[model samples]
Target chain A: MIEEGAGQVDGTIRAVLRDVLGLTQDRVNAFDESTPLFGLLPELDSMAVAGVLTELEDRLGITIEDDEVDGEMLETFGKLAHFLRKKALL
Target chain B: MLRFGPQDGPVVIAAPALFEEANRTRAFLVRILRLLGVHGIAGALPDLPGQGESLLPTHQATLAGWRDAFATAARHVSAVATVSIRGGALVDGPAPVSALWRLSPITGAEQVKELWRIRQAAHDRPKLRYDPARFIAELDVEVAGNRLAPGLLAAMNIAEPSSDAPVRTVRLDTNPRPADLKLPGRPLWRASEPDVDEPLAQALADDIAAWVHACVA
Candidate 1:
C-alpha cells in the first residue's frame, strides 16, 4: 500500500484536479481539504463528479466505489486525499 | 488505389455519453490513435460538440448530428477502419469500416441493467450492495437526462446492432482498456488489473502497425 506524504501524491492530486476537472490552480489551492467541493467548485456536479472520478480511476488505476464516498468526502481536499490514501491512492 | 499520406489513416469517432465515462476515456482514445499511428494506421478522433474539447453547444445535438461527424471523418480518410466502444457504434454510416472494435459493447437490456447497477454501486457507497431491480429503474433516468428527444433516446440505445448501421463488423470483441481502470477516486490496488497482457498491448499495437504499414505501402 502507498503510504501518505509521498512527495508526488500532492502534485498528482492537484494535476488530477486541474487537468481532469479543468479547474484553475488558484481555485484548486483556494480550497483546503475541509472545504465543501461539489458546491464550492460549481463546475463539479453529479455528472462532473462521475467524470472526475472516471478520470481519476483511469489515470491512477484506482477503483472508486460510489458507495465509498459522499458529498462530505467531496467537501475538502484533505478529506478526499484521506479517502484516496485510505484506499491506497497515495 | 488508396493514397498513403502521413495523416491518411483510419478515423475513430465516438458518441457523447453522460459525465465521467467520456472524460476518463479521453486519454485512452488519444493513446489508441497514437498507437495506430506507430502502426502506420494514423487515425483521427474528431471532437463532437458538447463533449471533449469540442465547444459545448447549447442545442443538444441528436444522434444523427453525432453520426454526421463520423461521416465527415470517414470522408477524409479513404483506406480506413473505425473503432468505437459503447455509444460509438451509433455514429456515421457503414464507416466503410475495415473493423469495428468496441472495447465493451452494450447490446441489450442487460447493458442497461449493468449501467445502473454500476453507478448505484458507486453512489450507494457504505452499503456496498447491488440492488438490480432498483438500479435498473434509476438507470432509465440517468440515461434519459443525456438525450433531449425520445426518438434520439431509442436511437442512442446502442444495444440495437442493426441501428448502428450497415457496416460489416470484423471483430466484435470487447477488451477493457486502461480507460476502464478505477483510480484516484478510489485507489490503485482497489482497481481492476489491466485487462490485456502488457505483451498483448504491445503486440496489438504492433499488429496494427504491420497492417497499417502494408496498407499504406
Candidate 2:
C-alpha cells in the first residue's frame, strides 16, 4: 500500500509538470530524481512555476501555502516530488 | 458578439474564462463554438463590458457588472443554455438560460488566488503576500497586468458558480474534483502563449452538443 501511494504521488507530480509546462510525455517519463528543473528547463519559467504549483494543489487535493515554496523544492524533479510526497502522503 | 451555427433553435451563449485565461483559450473556445455550429447548435460569444473590445477600462469592471452584462447578453441572444470555462463560471450566475454547462469551473476566491500567484511568480518573490480584504480596498491594484476595482476583487473573494439551474460540470481528467464528466486535455488556460488543442475542442464540442440535446429533450 505504501509503495502504491508513493507511486501515485510521483505520478501526480510528473503529470502536473507535463500538463503545465506542455512537456511531452516522453520527456517527463524520462525524469528521474536527478532531472534538473527550474533553471534548466526552458519551459519551466517563473510563470510556469505558479501554474505547476497550482495544478499540483488541484490534482492532489492539498493546499500549498506560498511560504512553503522555495528554489530548493523546485531545483530538481526529485526534490519537487519529495516536497509533494510530504504534503500529500502524510 | 460572435455567432455561429444555425439561425434558429436552442442557442448557447458562451462565457470565456476571465483575464489571461481568456486570452490563452480564446482560439480554443472559438474552435469549440465553430464545432458546435457544425453540430447544428447555434453559439454566441459576447464581449463582456471591460473585456474583449468593450470601451470600458479594465479597472472599472465589477463582478456584479460582469454578471449583469452576461445576463443581458444571454437575454439578447435568447440563449437556451449558458456555457462557461474556468472563471467564466463566475460571470454566468445570473443569466436566464435554462441550463448551465461549465468546464473546470472555479470559485471566485480561487480565481483571485490564481491572479495573486501569477503576480508573485512574475516578480520571483515567494514571500510577497497581501491580505485580500485590505488589498482590494486599495486603488489601482493590478494583478497580472489587469487593473481591477476593489468591488470586483471583494466580490470575487466570496462569489461562487451559481447552482440555480441544472448544471453540468466538466473537468480535465487531471483534476480530482467530482464532475459530471472529465475529458483528457492539457489546460490551454495555463499555456505560456495562446494555443489550440483541436482534439480537446472536438471532444468538448461533442460533449456540449450531447448535453444540450439531453437538456432540451
Candidate 3:
C-alpha cells in the first residue's frame, strides 16, 4: 500500500510537468531521479513554475504554501516527487 | 462579438477564462464555439468590460461590472445557455441564461490565489506570502501584465460561481473535483503559449450542444 501510494505521487508529479510544460508523454516518462528541471528545462520558466506548482497542488490534493516552494524542491524530478510524497503520502 | 451558427436558434453566450488564462485558452475556446456552430448551436463570444476588445482600462474593471456586462450581452443575444471556462464562470452567474455549462470552473478566491502565485513567480521570489487582506486593501494591483482594481480582486476573493441557474460542470480527468463529466485533456489554460486542442474542443462542443438542447427543450 505504501509503495502504491508513493508511486501515485510520483506519477502525479510527472503528469503535472507534462501537462503544465506542454511536454510530450514520452519526454516526461523518460525522466528519472536525476533528471534536471527548473532552469535546465527551457519550458519550465518562472511562469511555468507557478503553473506546475498549482497543478501539482490541485492534483495531489495538497496545498503548497508559497514559502514551501524553493529551487531545491524543483531542482530534480526526484526532488519534486520527494516533496510531493512528503506532502501527499503523509 | 463573435457569432456562430444560425441567427435565431438557441444561442450560447461564451465567457472565456479570465486574465492570462484567457490568452492561453482563446484559440481552444474559439474552436469549441466553431464546433458548436457545426452542431447547429448558435454561439456568441463577447468582450466583457476591460477584457478582450473592450475599451475599459483593466484597472477600472470591477467584478460587478463584468457580471453586468455579461448579463447585458446575453440580453442582447437572447442567449438560452452560458458556456463559461475557468474564471469566466464567475461572470456568467448574472447572465439571464436558463442553463450554465462550466469547464473546469474555479472560484474567485482560487483565481486570486493563482494570480498571486503567478505574480510571485514573475518576481522570482517563492517565499512571498499571499496576504489577501493586504492585497485587497491596496490600490489597483498589477497581476501578471494586467492592472486589476483592488475592489475587483476583493470581490473575486469571496465570489463563488452563481448557482442560481442549472449548472453542468465538466472537469479534466486529472482534476479530482466532482463534475458531471471528466474529459481527457490537458489544461490549455496552463500552457505556456496559446494552443489548440481540437479533440478537446470537439468533445466540449458536443457536450455543450447536447446540454443546450436539453435545456431549451
Compare the candidates by DockQ and give the number of the best one.
3
C-alpha-based local distance difference test score of model 2: 0.88
Q: Model 3: residues >4 Å from true position, as ranges? A: none
Q: Model 1: per-residue lDDT, tens digit, B17-94? A: 223345445544455555666654656566665555666452365556666666665665653555554445545345
Tell me the deviation in Å of residue B42 in model 2.
0.7
- Which digits, one per residue and each the tens of the lDDT, describe model 3 over residues A1-59? 88999999988888888888888899999999999998898999989988988898888
Instruction: Give the candidate order by descending DockQ.
Output: 3, 2, 1
Model 3 vs. true fold: TM: 0.98
Task: Give candidate 1 regions above 4 Å deviation.
Answer: A1-7, A29-31, B1-79, B83-96, B99-216
The C-alpha TM-scores of every prediction are 0.46, 0.95, 0.98
**Lowest summed lDDT window (length 10), candidate 1 chain A:** A1-10
Candidate 1 on A1-90: residue-level lDDT in tens?
244444345555675676545666887767566766767776665545654665555445577765666777877788777777656443
- For the candidates in turn, chain A alone yields TM-scores of 0.76, 0.96, 0.96
Docking class of 1: incorrect
Candidate closer to the true structure by TM-score (higher is better), 1 or 3: 3
Judge candidate 3 at residue B211 and give its lDDT.
93
**lDDT of the structure predicted as candidate 3:** 0.90
Question: What TM-score does the A-chain of candidate 1 achieve?
Answer: 0.76
User: What is candidate 2's lDDT per residue for B50-144, written digit by digit as tens?
Assistant: 88888999988888899999999999999989999999999998999779999999998899888888877776664754466665566666767
Model 1 chain B weakest lDDT span, ten residues long: B182-191
